[model samples]
Target: MLTVYNLKMPHAVYGGENAMDNITAILKNHQAKRVALFTDGGILASGLFTLPEAAVKAAEAEYYVLSDIPPEPSYTAVQQIVDQFKENGADMIIAVGGGSVLDAAKLASVLVTDEYGVKELLDTPGRAKKCVPTILIPTTAGTGAEVTPNAIVAVPEKELKIGIVNENMIADYVILDARMVKNLPRPIAAATGVDALAHAIECYTSKKANPFSDTFALEALDLILNHILPACDDPEAMEAKNRMQIAAFYAGIAITASGTTAVHALSYPLGGKYHIAHGVSNAILLAPVMRFNAPVCEDRLAKAYDRCCHEAENRCQSDSEKAEWVIGKIEEIVRHLNIPTSLKEFGVPKEDLDGLVEAGMLVQRLLVNNMREVTPEDARNLYLEIL
Candidate 1:
């Protein structure tokens, strides 16, 4: 842990029954006449935008929809959306979708300047400042993009996804209505739920783990490990889904203080080059990376096992046993969720090992946070295992 640590959070967060109604109140408080609603076609098609739309109308605020954002979007793609948002003459932004939509909205909030765009931020993330206040409503029980000061976008030329971190990008308001994710598709729920799981475990074992992060990480682990399956497998499991939404938010808060480790570091290349979904990529790499770090993080893992498996903690005799059980439980959860555990299904070629190693090693921001050091050789072996 660092000698000094800090925590940052949104100005306000609203959740539980009728959380979307807060949107109208927020709009009235901001005294906004025009609002830009950000989302994707899938959301619009599924009518998931209804509640937010109703809230926006209730505020009597005229709004325009920007729904061109795509999954695993490139920096250029984000730039395009930001440009469009600027032309809309909107005073506030309400983003309602998955990670991609939220990230694009966050970038838009900061990139309102003509002096710099998303591409420029890749080089100097601190150059831009937030000009428009944003209300982020997550449509998935994962990603936590709503609360983070980070925005991830694919860098096409580099064939790697990069995160643009700036305190200015954090949401001014976050709405965590479980109704938004209540009917999420099984595949999406599974992938994103595991992604939250990765965030919780990774932050707990991070080299930067501190009291602020541990408080949220452990609670998030308990909530997610216990509720994720029921949340994803049962369409009517609103209670479980609500717990997952909160767990993802807590895990995301943990990330702000402690950051993620090798699993996220290595998953970027897969999303950047192979166009794999970010959550799915993390799901694929989670277990293998944790198993690699087991020796160095066994104590942390044992603690996590104790917290997450309270009912079964007596089954393990030693710290090593507890640690192994935690890892095994992760594997079991992934298997039960039906998320693919290998790159083979994605058509990732074994011959691309050298390229994958090169790209993954470049994510030093996260690699340095791993409790156990990850060398290029280790990255290659890990990728090879998945392939």
Candidate 2:
């Protein structure tokens, strides 16, 4: 029997052009002072810093930016900021970049009152009661870090991706100013948009799917289906990027409630082992995972598959026909976006498949959420099939 579940997001999420202008009001409502701004260097140099920098001044607080974030940030990197925030005495944090930067800030807050090292969040595999308030400002359309309760962090010694990095790491606020995404590379735009699409699809089809989350997921899917290509085609079009960015955030909220299933569970190993980047990993694994789950979800996915496919491909009227059409559409998008199609492309040997399988099995949080019960053997077969 299906059940009803409540869905929630950050306090407020603002989208569209000049959206950052509302930051002062958001901070005023929260009475944020002594802020520590967290972001990557690229965004630090991207002129976006100006808005937040000015907002901190207008709000009359001592906000300093820590911009040394990497493409794949580790817990050790986040500790550096935590120590600084401790000494600097920040009451609130302003996270202003892609998912990585926002995640770093979220994790840093967890370490604020930690008796042990910052690594506890990654190593413990559970929830934390102590964390500081962070206002998340997403500069990209993918990752949806702002609304997501979980943060994906890589741990070097463990050689694994931490999906259950911290359950309570959810942000206090999320500002989705589309202006920040205007400068993203077209390829980055396409890849992240696909990540958002995967988030919606997998959550909607998962074992934990519920009525409320399904509403957000399906609506998010519809927006991405129509607007992602436009955002990629013309990055400066704030309208298109705005819709996709909003869709990504809503998808994040949707998945937080229902959880992402097979596609996400399978995508993790690729990113953890190969360092393929999360979105690219999802793009590589989505088609194969969808095909694998087709037997269970075909009845539900048929309509989505049709909508995702273009007119040229959807002429075939049957559901199975539409499934094939959907695969073709995805391949076209991946090909145009210039992401590799297989693990071999990332130099994962036939030998490395098992290692990837073992790593994935360790992420029980996401693996258990699969629409069907999955064993290590099942995961191995899926990796081998893709390999």
Candidate 3:
């Protein structure tokens, strides 16, 4: 049944506490002299970048620090960073933050060498020309921006989020340091962990999925589903943080290979219109979408459920039972972590349901990946069910 499948990823370097120990050698390998360090203000404020900053300084590479990336990356914001990188003449880029910062750096790194600007790059695919070598160090356990070849950018005027899908956008190196996420806030740990879980689940159930992606997604799902609660309970637990980071990276590979489905497609409008956090939006839509997809994807759901349960045969009598059990487990986790379960609770007015449906319809790229077809009507009903 498998025709073709490919899994893409950066050269990942994983370690605990000593993850940055090899940064110096990596820079030397790339022969990067002038470097641009990209991150957000909050990460810089938290001092997580202190070690990397010191490493760049110690290497005596001419470096410029830009901490102005927004919570959600925008086209205009990416252009500003590109300008800085061009001005500094940086031969290399190092991104250290969550998804937004890493994505912004990815777009800017490739755009800096190309004749095309942000608008042209977003509008045209395969126009990306490889530019400066870049390294991504994630401070959070979610988003998996470290290993993925995709970057999401928001266009405020259009109220739409667009992804730059190009292999050239993938980072040259991904550093997974347990120390960086040791002090992560509880809410972020919960939200990002859920985000990784959604990525794993959606990719596994996507229509394009094949053996390669299934292996990665299931492994990632098992890791996240098992450790998310403990990770949320103890922020400083190194084992939980480490596993979450690896799980997110594995999910990133899965999503890249198979793509995400209706859940991500439906969550986009909330992020675009309400500025709701992406993970929170996904968390709200996860269960309802799974419920809707059950008829077609029950076997897939059951397989995932079995991985979560120690005694699957005794607990789940049928595919329907397994699907419901999986949905119930997700709901339980969301509740325990205090994630709002309804669109209304997330501050979407009842009247705006139609608008949300319209927005969801626009994300055909992700919708087509759903195992079960999701029409505009299906999107509306799913939102209404959540409401």
Q: What is the lDDT of residue 216 in candidate 3?
A: 87
The estimated TM-scores of all candidates read 0.99, 0.92, 0.96
Candidate 2: which stretches are off by over 4 Å? 1-4, 123-127, 165-167, 306-316
Candidate 1 local lDDT, 223-261, one digit each (tens): 999999999999999999999999999999999988999
Distance from true location, Cα of 185 in model 3, Å? 0.7
lDDT of each: 0.93, 0.76, 0.85
Runs in model 3 deviating more than 4 A are: 311-314
Per-residue lDDT over 1-387 for candidate 3, one digit per residue giving the tens place of the 0 to 100 score: 136978777765556667876777887777788888999988988989898888787676788898889898778888887887777778889999999999988888788655787778777858997688888998877988888888888877767677778899888888888888888888888888899999999999999888988998999988988888888898567798789988998898887888888998888888878787888889999988988888998998899988877653567779889888888888899999998888775667889888888888988889999988998899989989887
Q: How close is candidate 3 to the true structure, as a TM-score?
A: 0.96
Give candidate 3's whole-model lDDT.
Answer: 0.85
Ranking of models by lDDT: 1, 3, 2
Candidate 1: 10-residue stretch with minimal lDDT: 306-315
Residue 258 in candidate 3, Cα distance off native in Å = 0.9
- Top candidate (lDDT): 1
